[model samples]
Target: MPSPFRHTTPPEPASAAGPVRAVYTQLARDFGITRAPTFVVLSSVPEIMASAWALMRESLIAGDGGRTGKELAALGVSEANRCPFCVDAHKMLLHATGDHALAERVARGEQPADEDQARVLAWGRATRIPGAPELTPYPFPAAHAPAYIGTALAFHFINRVVSALLTERLLPGNVQRFRAVRSLGGRSLSRTVRRHPAPGAGLTLLDGAGLALLDHAGPGPDWARATTVGPAYAALRAAAGEGERLLDADDRILVRETLGAWDGAHPPLAWDGLPGRDRPGARLALLAALAPYRITEEDVAAWRTPDRTDAALVRLVAYGAFAAVDRIESALPVRTAKEAS
Candidate 1:
């Protein structure tokens, strides 16, 4: 099959080695998909790919939160970000959860009939807002907050990555658009969705191996402290930090300041304060952080050159997305249960 990647060459899953291979292996065994484009796009940075997979696998796939609820949260985030690809993928995953009615309802842009799911969906979407009051009383159980919170945060990053790096179609020929295809695709992975993966199974790809080499990998945010989510979060943070080298120090500061002042509302069509063509990388970064869907072909074209490779674009966008994630994480209330001792 042709790779879903547009701007860069995706790693050959067949010949991938070490941590990259481990991530592919786990995705097949645990995520039930052999070639996940969202992840393969990061294979240029094996540690980042492994770290990102760990966060998603631990929280969305194996963590303690309800699977259907996590899917709702993920879908909510995708909706908020306007990532059509992720939105489609999540609706299919929702079908995998066997809530076809709910999936169809959400796909139709309708609120779920169930009050709890409605709240969960709302909470997931609302997470994009920094310090929004709705965030205070989390919709899921406090004890299960790590999984729920991790799932939301993970998608916050993943959605940005997808919108900026990948094309809009989740599958070839846009096959996922058909209701039957969506259900069938979801059904294909129902076993993986229902099976309980060993908690922290993704760590096998990150730990003790040279994969954990990021210097700034800290214990993660207070909201995600005391769980497997922390290390995974930290590794991703450190990995994304690699983008700092792509832009001038001043451009990085500009992107951070822009994201810090953001209100989670989409910017006006004009998107003021963005740099001009002279600073295409920064422009792309800021867009990735706050309004990835707004990014255009010209925008990417402006930054990409013979000198800048696909891996660099991925890093630059990851940096921008994580800047926004940092802002979101900073404002996140401690709604989850206190860290385990």
Candidate 2:
């Protein structure tokens, strides 16, 4: 099937070269799929690709909570974000974990029959809102905290990327829904998903600030730390670049101002009151920041021109995702050691 991405194309599973090559190879060897559509779009920037893949692998796939719990968390986030791509992917992953009945119920928008599964799903949905609940007496056990939070955050970043860059179509048509097709899809990931490095494994590459961010919220679980660093650094790095390629001087100021004054709520943009509403990149940035789930093709159509390359869109989206992630992270109730224990 032809790709829905207009800016970037998926690299050949065998054909990817450079920094992404090693990561792609590891994904193929470990997970069965060589190039995930999400990672493929992220490959527009090799650094983003490598960093995102490592963080996601450590937190979601390989972290403390079981795959079933993590997929539930991911599903909650994607559902809140209204991202069909990730919703379908996680449903497939749940089935891959050998819970076809539960997967079907979730795919059909039913709650899981299990109580613990229901709690996890509830927490994930709550996490999408700014300051919705406290982490104290978290629904799951302390050990599972990192895995759950990390999974939510990772998809918080990923759902945005998918919504902005990729199309919603999982397969050419409804073929993605066929039992045989999704099951075969599940088989491919069954092997590699369980092979991730132990959660909280130290990252050798992080600098002082990066390390501090991981450590800032106290001696949290390893998976949580890994999850925080991945999105935080990736967002900061994207900000360091020439995002101006999309938003001009005034548009940049508008984005920063809007985000700075944000109250951690997804408010509707009074398009008439917003700055840079006329510029597609700026409009996309605001939608990503305030109401990412609300972003539509019209938003993209407004900003994209012959000159706006896929690379630019990727960076712009990354910036908005990080902006929102940063806000959510700051408002997240910091867990104390006593509370964590």
Candidate with maximal lDDT: 1
Tens-digit per-residue lDDT, 1-341, candidate 2: 67756445555656766556766765676556777788888776655565556556666776666888888888888887778888888888887787778888887788999988887887777666767763444667666666566667778778877876788877778566777777777766776665555533323212221332233323333335434434434433343244545677888887877777776554755555354537777778777666665667677667777777666677777777766666665666647412554
Candidate 1 local distance difference test against the native: 0.85
Candidate 2's TM-score reads: 0.80
**Per-residue accuracy of model 1 over 30-63 as CA lDDT, tens digit each:** 9999779999898888877888899899889988
lDDT of 2 at 294: 63
Minimum summed lDDT over a 10-residue window in model 1 is located at 332-341
TM-score of each: 0.94, 0.80
Error of 2 at 294 (Å): 5.9
